[model samples]
Target: MARDPNEPMPDGSGCALQEPFALQVLGADMEPEFPDKCVVIIEPTEFCRSGMYVFAEVEGVRWFRQYLRDEQGRERLVALNDIFPAIELNGLDWKVLGVIIQRNIRRKIKTYEYADGPSNQPHGSINAVDITAS
Candidate 1:
């Protein structure tokens, strides 16, 4: 069967770089939740809110971190692990490239979906679950 030209390939082959892309987690910065070597699918979007795992570019350098907005509306990029210091976006030039929507650990697929309405969780928080293949 022929594949769709617009669909993103697992290996990123023949797909537009601007579209949703898969990237391998390289460090323990986002450990526990997103372990090293795990593959994450990033959906390009400009409408990122608080508490979303996002791929962003800061001062010309790209990073994968959790987007955060404090009560006062101050924004920052934080690592899941406490060891890594947070990147405050108060006066920095930053742009969110995409939000992580899926993660693949080993052969298990874990999906991260945003909540629809108001909830106890933070705004734009994700609900992650393991998706079993039948």
Candidate 2:
């Protein structure tokens, strides 16, 4: 496991001992899927595979991005939103801290339901419903 460069020396506070952790998505780099403020569950011990969502260290900086292999078989980090440029892996000191296994959407999910009773109803209008409970 790669230690955080800015982390203070362990003083037996036991802050490091824990299970799967959660991180809040903070930018538009991973939008449409991992929207801003959404909580993601990270499993540190899970085996990471290609195209997995992971938090990694790149040149002493922690970055949350999707892990992928480029056409030339190079490991690269990509942002879901195309507005951000992909980070290419090269001489940087990088390590996968964990893979995202689940996401807790803090925003509302829009769902459509039939407004009228469905007894073989034809062309019924749909009512928009927002499911916000997490």
Candidate 3:
């Protein structure tokens, strides 16, 4: 049997259910952008727009992908790497868990901020900064 995606996974950290959290990228599915083992900060929100790197649940499986909503109103979860096929979300049971706001790659922090309205870009304005210095 598959686990219910709505139910939160236990981390034993005792973090608040609705608070922001960090997750380590486990695969190259989102590679070139979010490389394997990179840490990402997720901001829990009920409002998720297009062009955001989002943590979502689809068909009982949790996924981290770029959320896309086309002009025809079709929705999809796309991997940054082309090796993975995009997940079309027309009739599937899916929900956005949160939007990735920051990514840490070897002490370099890349911040992602979405515009107030819809966007055609895959990722909105990004600002990268090195935090290696104290």
Per-residue lDDT of model 1, residues 8-115, tens digit only: 677534447558889999999998889999999999877787888999999999999998887798999999899999999999988988999999999899999876
What's the lDDT of the predicted structure labeled candidate 1?
0.87
Tell me the lDDT of model 3 at 74.
Answer: 93
Cα error, candidate 3, residue 70 (Å): 0.5
Q: After best superposition, candidate 1 residue 126: deviation in angstroms?
A: 1.4
Q: Model 3 segments beyond 4 Å from truth?
A: 1-15, 118-134
Model 3, residue 73: what's the lDDT? 98
The number of clashing residue pairs in each candidate reads: 0, 0, 0
For candidate 1, the 10 contiguous residues with the lowest summed lDDT are 116-125
Q: Residue 22, candidate 2: how far off, in angstroms?
A: 0.7
Model 1: pairs clashing at backbone N, Cα or C within 3 Å: none
Worst 10 residues of 2 by lDDT: 116-125
What is the Cα-based lDDT of residue 90 in candidate 1? Answer: 94
- Which one wins on lDDT? 1
After superposition, the stretches of candidate 1 with alpha carbons farther than 4 Å from their true spots are 1-18, 116-119, 122-124
